[model samples]
Target chain A: MIIDVHVHTRLGPDPHGFAYLLDQAAELDVTLCVNSLSPKDGTGMPESPTEDEIRRCNDWTAELAAAHPERIIPMWYLNPAHEDFACRELEERLAAHAGLQGVKLWVAVRCNDPRLDPIMRLCAEHKLPVLQHTWFKVTGNLPGESTPMDLRELALRHPDVSFFWGHCGGDYEYGAKCARGLPNVYMDLGGGEAMNGYVDLLVEHETADHIVFGSDAPGRSLISQLAKVYGADLSDEEREKILHRNAQALFDQQKPANGAAS
Target chain B: MIDANAYLGNWPFRKLRYTTHIALLDKMDALGIEKAVVSSLENVFYKDQLAGNRRLHSEVHPHADRLLPAFTINPTFPGWEEDLDVCVQEFGMRVIRLHPNYHQYGLDSAAGSAVLDAARAHNFVVILATGLEDTRHHHPLVKVPDVPAEQVAAAVSAYADVQFLVAAANFSGVSAVWTEAAHTANVHFEISRVQGPVGDIEKLCGTVGADRVLLGTNLPLHVPEAATLAIEHAKITAAERRMIVQENATRLFGLG
Candidate 1:
């Protein structure tokens, strides 16, 4: 089965959003892992959310997972800068909810930041996979924006936790290299700011099992994102691993420890 | 469905093993792209624009059944008129693409105007290569900004008699040129990189007329089925989908 390891729900509290997303994914014959980051706050300039807003986002995802036990999975979208709240929320939610699949980190803090240490430790205890947003080829060497190297640094520090490099390093050629020797760092192929041969290059350098398929949908085309995997010249077995098996293995390995549903 | 935009040749930044015209054809067949209007990377990279045009025409001639040549014409280049004539008169090329950003000329410049005038006289469809890749993720050594929307609007306004297609434009690029795209009847947009939301195609069509949007995949640099499948699965009526996939491009390119 094709499991999309990355997707975002419609921003804000629209009760109908998750249902709509599930329906759309059904058309492609794939299940979804919806990151509960509101489009309004998840992207653009990062805004600090109140504790209530954070709870609301996580709670919304938890509820969606409850509704679709078999079709949809939830990833905890946490602002690592709010370490205490993030840690508390993960503990609270994962304790009660077994379907919460992984943790998603965006530009809240660089993947290499020491501030992320506590959150990383917490995820390690729970054995939750970490998906960190990464990009390159943009203006302004912004302080908090994580690069492939930054992600590599963090993955090196914590060999136990698997890191999904979002956007495949977002136009950075070195993304595949970051995963070359690191068994824990896998790449999630997504992003429009990509070049041809990007996926092919990744497969060549890192092998296919270390990569996962993500659409970054609503903001991107699911068909297009899948093409990044399907269009690549990989064996059926390799493609299957990237499309579903790798993710299934990662999430499943953690399930017995964290008690998430298979 | 016609792919309004596609490409052949090497991208300096990334390796695309399928850079040959024949390789593009294999890809086209696999993706179910009936016809593709293509430009050459040589046109954007080569200093001498005419040489690039000749190379593109020569390369695409054998595969004329599925591939249609869209020559690159930089107005600022010397002997541009002759090159335009060669593309039009000699090669019978109907489509001409301009790289305003790469050519280092504004759309409103004398050079730009002269090319537009020649294109008008010769009855050529003009495709403004507004963007090659997203500006945010461009290589650090070579930063190519997208052609500003205001410039596109100005050109569209100036050349009201000419049919203009904005190529490789994203949503922001569309917004920048939305007024011209909506107001100017001759102005059209190609969706090679316009992605957002679930029903973004319907949203764009709702904002602009469905008639103005054309199918583009930015192929070789992008996966062709990405756009083709996206269009096929869009939440629009059959008629609307048909227009975007084939009818609109067929009519615009005079591929009757």
Candidate 2:
């Protein structure tokens, strides 16, 4: 079975909604591992969601994961742009959701910005794997969206922390080059319309161990993202690492029982 | 399954994994893809685009039965009728693709209207792409805009007699595009850009009806297995799956 590391809440509308997401994962025999709690819509929050909106989205995500602990793995989303309240927010959420395993950084600010330093230090202290939304768009980027290169810099700065580089920055050719030889970064397979060398190129540069599977589902496709791995004609060992092993290893590092933070 | 939206030639910005027909055939054979309706990437950049069509003929003719070739024309070009005649008469092409974004003209332009008239007269399946690549990641200097879904919807309604194959259909704000055209029987969509299991593919099938959806991978550019698995694993019925995978394409392309 495959583990999807990059799913969002409220994938789409149906009578079932989130229930449908879990049921479909069950039907497809996929494990719904990690989620970026945006809202009912699969698209993430407005680049910088209001503090109250952020609190509400995270609360909803925790409840959804709690209902299906066997299937769902929840990530704590942080918007460092709320620089004044961001650190306090993380502490309060962590105290509340003891088992949250990962950290989600959306496009509100670049990962390397000084604004995120306190957040990064807190994650490093907690051993949380940060899944940052990084894309290099040609048309343009969001006000402060990070790119693979930005993540690469952040990875070098925080060597002990694990980073799931979301969508490999869209253009896999450039993304692969940035990820090559970076042991801390794991290329996320999600969101973008993948091409012929999406997996092979990344594996050639980063190897299968450094690459993980993520279905930006509800907004994207689960099977389609899974097929990016399964259809790569990889060996069993390579497939296993991407399908579940790498993600499981990353998740295991989180200090689940030690959620206390001032 | 038949891959209805594969491409050949250089991408200009980046090198493709497969740029030749031999590689495509080997891939199709391995994946059990019987036939693929293909267009040219090289043509989109060319001034005449007819050269790219001629190049495609040379490359695909050897495996004609399996590689169903489609010709592209810049309908805005003067006397495009002669070019269409060549593609139809000399090349025996059955599909005429348009890249108004690459060709730099509005789909509602007078020249665009003339092409629609030609499409009605020629009775060839007209394949228009919502986009070949995400404009967000396109070369910043190129400044290519996507063919808005509403524009495609408008054409589908106006050219009621011509078969419109919307390739790489954009799912973002799709209602404005596909839902508008859903009422028409002449419009069909290729799933090169659509995904499933909560990606709302079933909703698309429900709205447009299954018979109007065809399987497309945008291959040598996208994963063939991904396209096949999307329908196989979609929530729609097996019969809907069957229609999406091959039957719809077989009927649209007139494959015997």
Candidate 3:
């Protein structure tokens, strides 16, 4: 089964929001792990999401996932800065909607920041996978931006939790190398230029089992993103692991050990 | 559609194992790309661009039927004008690509203007590679920024008689120079690194007439099939698709 681990409903109210994503997902023939996004302007992401904004985004995600249980899988987006509030909301939301399969951490706090410890702890308890936003900026690693190394440190800190590094650390080559032997760390092929040789490098240097397919949809096209892996020179076995097997295995592990969510 | 932006030779930063002209053509053939305008990656990093262009001419010679040479010329280098003449006169290369970001030359400098003039004089199609790789993914030790779009637009406006193709201008980069690209008649864009929603090709076609866009994959650096799929999946009329994928470039380069 082809699965896209990264997708969003919409940041704002558009009559054609979830409908648009569903239609595209059908055309692309992949199950989507849909997340919520705060309202955004043309420039980029919305200013740090407010408490109400976070709640609304999570609501939208749950509604869509519940509507298409077979196709749409919900992943919660949290702002770790609002530590107590975020933790409260995640508990309330997950209890309310049992369909949430993962957690998405944006640039609200560095992956290594202690602020994320609570969220990571919660994920570890729930056995939920974490997809953290990462970008390898030219200006050097900024405060909020999560590099692959930062993710490596975090993944090492929480060995019980599974962390999917987003955008393959933006640059990918270094990201793949950093993720090599970290059993808990997985790489998602998302965002940025689909640099040539990057995917091959990942498969050769980093095990294909460690890489997952993610299309940062609505902002980018699925075909273009899929082409990054589909067009790469990889074996059928390696391609299968990246396209679905690995992601399925990750989700299959989310059994909420000890009835953690309840 | 003929790809207006392609490359031969190795890039020092990455192991693009498929760097030979033959490998490029075989890959292009697999993707159904009949022809492509090619250049050498050596030109991107080498200080002696003359030698790089010469190497490109020789490498592309065997497969001249499928690969058309786009020689790189750094205007700031001494004897660059003579090198340009050799690129056109000796090699008969019709397209001249400039890497101001890699070569460290201002697009608006006097030497830059002279290079544009020489291309115009020889009727060469000019491809200003706005960027080769995304800045966020550049090799740490040698990070190269994209050639400023503003400078490219200014140059395009300054030389109306010369046709300028902007290669590797992603969605943001295109938006940054939208006003200038819209007003300037001679400026065209190559859709190699343009990232947007599903109907992005159509969106760009509407913004800058379809005639102003060309098919480019930046192959050996990108997936050629991916570039083609983007065009094939875009919501556009057959005529508009024809213009973007082939006719515009064919006419611009006098491919006939």
Candidate 4:
């Protein structure tokens, strides 16, 4: 089954609404998609979404998941800067929606900001996986975006929490290098730039297990981006892991079969 | 079926994805690509135009029937004339690729004009590669400065008698350059870099005619399936698709 993890719904700034996105995904034969909330910072915190807005977005996702059932898996977007509000909303969403898999954070906040500790602690307590938007300082396009070094610091800070670095080996080769020994951290291959030697990089570095497939849909086409990975020279087993198994395994670990919260 | 713009070898900052030649070829072959005019990643990084060119030529030249070598020449190199001569004479490179931003030279400069002349003199087809990735989404420090369309227009005007291929250029860039150059009979636009829901080749062909658009897969860097699908799914007639895919390139590059 083709699953795209990095998907955006009309819950935020996208001009294209949720219905349009769903229709496009369905047309593309996407069985499963992780619909993430686009962050909003009315407070002028650069890329962070407001607390009330985040709650509303999560509520909308929960409603949508209820309607679609197995098709859509809502991934909560949280800004740790909102401290207590973030934990409250996370707990509220977890209690409200059993289908919700994990949390998505745009670490565009700042490299290793201490305020994020509470948010990571909450995820650790709930056993929820966190996907951070990561890149290298030099190669990353965004001026204020967090680098792989920042992600390494964040991973080291919260060793028990499962952190998935979004964009995988994007432009920064150092992210792959830093993620080699860190098992708790996984990388999503999508967005920004395409790396020249991605498959061999994963194999030689022995970080194949940490790599997962994600297409920053809308910004890119689901079919075309998936084709890049599908057409790559990887073993069937390795392709399966990157395509679906790894994501399923990560999500399953966070929410076990018993329907327990943690 | 040779793609004029393809890259092998390693791009720094990322792990070497496709290491061996067979590994790269097998992937390209799956996409229906028969032969590719490829350059080494080392040439892109160390700026050692000839060494990287020779390394690529030596590896792929033995299998020249399958892999055609296109030497990447850095106009910034002090001994660029000697390098260009060696590439054409020793390796039989008929095509040369230029990375303006990567090599830190303006295509409008006097030196760049000389490089163009040298390429024309050797009967080599010049391919100007615009941007590898979208600048908005690129690494902040790895700035992909636009390959000035006016400079390309000026070059086309300067050498109306010679033919050139522009790879990774957008629709607007193609249109602007072609319009200014007036006589675009000698220019061919490589379609891998320009993408949209609508087929760019069909649209461009309607404007610039089918003969000016050719099939190019920035393979390894880009997936060929979508581009291939775009050409296949275009609104143009089968004859036109054939022209864009094979006939146009065959005629322009003298591949037949």
Highest-DockQ candidate? 1
Summing lDDT over every window of 10 consecutive residues in candidate 3 chain B, give the lowest-scoring window.
Answer: B175-184
Estimate, for each residue in A1-262, the C-alpha lDDT of model 4 and write its tens digit: 6556776554324345345546655665554445446422222223666776677666666666777766677778777778888888887777777664678777547548887898888778777778788765443346446777778888998998887777763543566777778878877766643334454465556455777776665454454456556555678888888787777777776556427422
Estimate the TM-score of every prediction: 0.93, 0.92, 0.93, 0.76
Top candidate (lDDT): 3
Global Cα lDDT for candidate 4: 0.69
lDDT of 3 by residue, A1-262 (tens): 6888888776333435456657767776788988877633322355467787788778878877778887887789899889899899888866776653889987777888888888888888887889988877765865677888888889989999998789888888778878878898778887766667778888887788889998787667676788888788889999999998998888876645434321
User: Which of the CAPRI classes, incorrect, acceptable, medium or high, describes model 2?
Assistant: medium
lDDT of 4 at B117: 82
lDDT of 3 by residue, B1-256 (tens): 6998999888887788568887887888788788899998888888788898888888888778778899998888888888877877789878999888888888788878888888888888899999887787777788888888788878887778888888998866776676764357878888889855545676688888788888899988887666788888776889988998889988888776
User: Which pairs clash in the backbone of model 3?
Assistant: none
> On a 0 to 1 TM-score scale, where does candidate 3 land against the true structure?
0.93
Would you list the C-alpha lDDT of every candidate in the order shown? 0.78, 0.78, 0.80, 0.69
Per-model i-RMS? 2.3, 2.3, 1.9, 4.7
Among all windows of ten consecutive residues in candidate 4 chain A, which has the lowest summed lDDT? A37-46
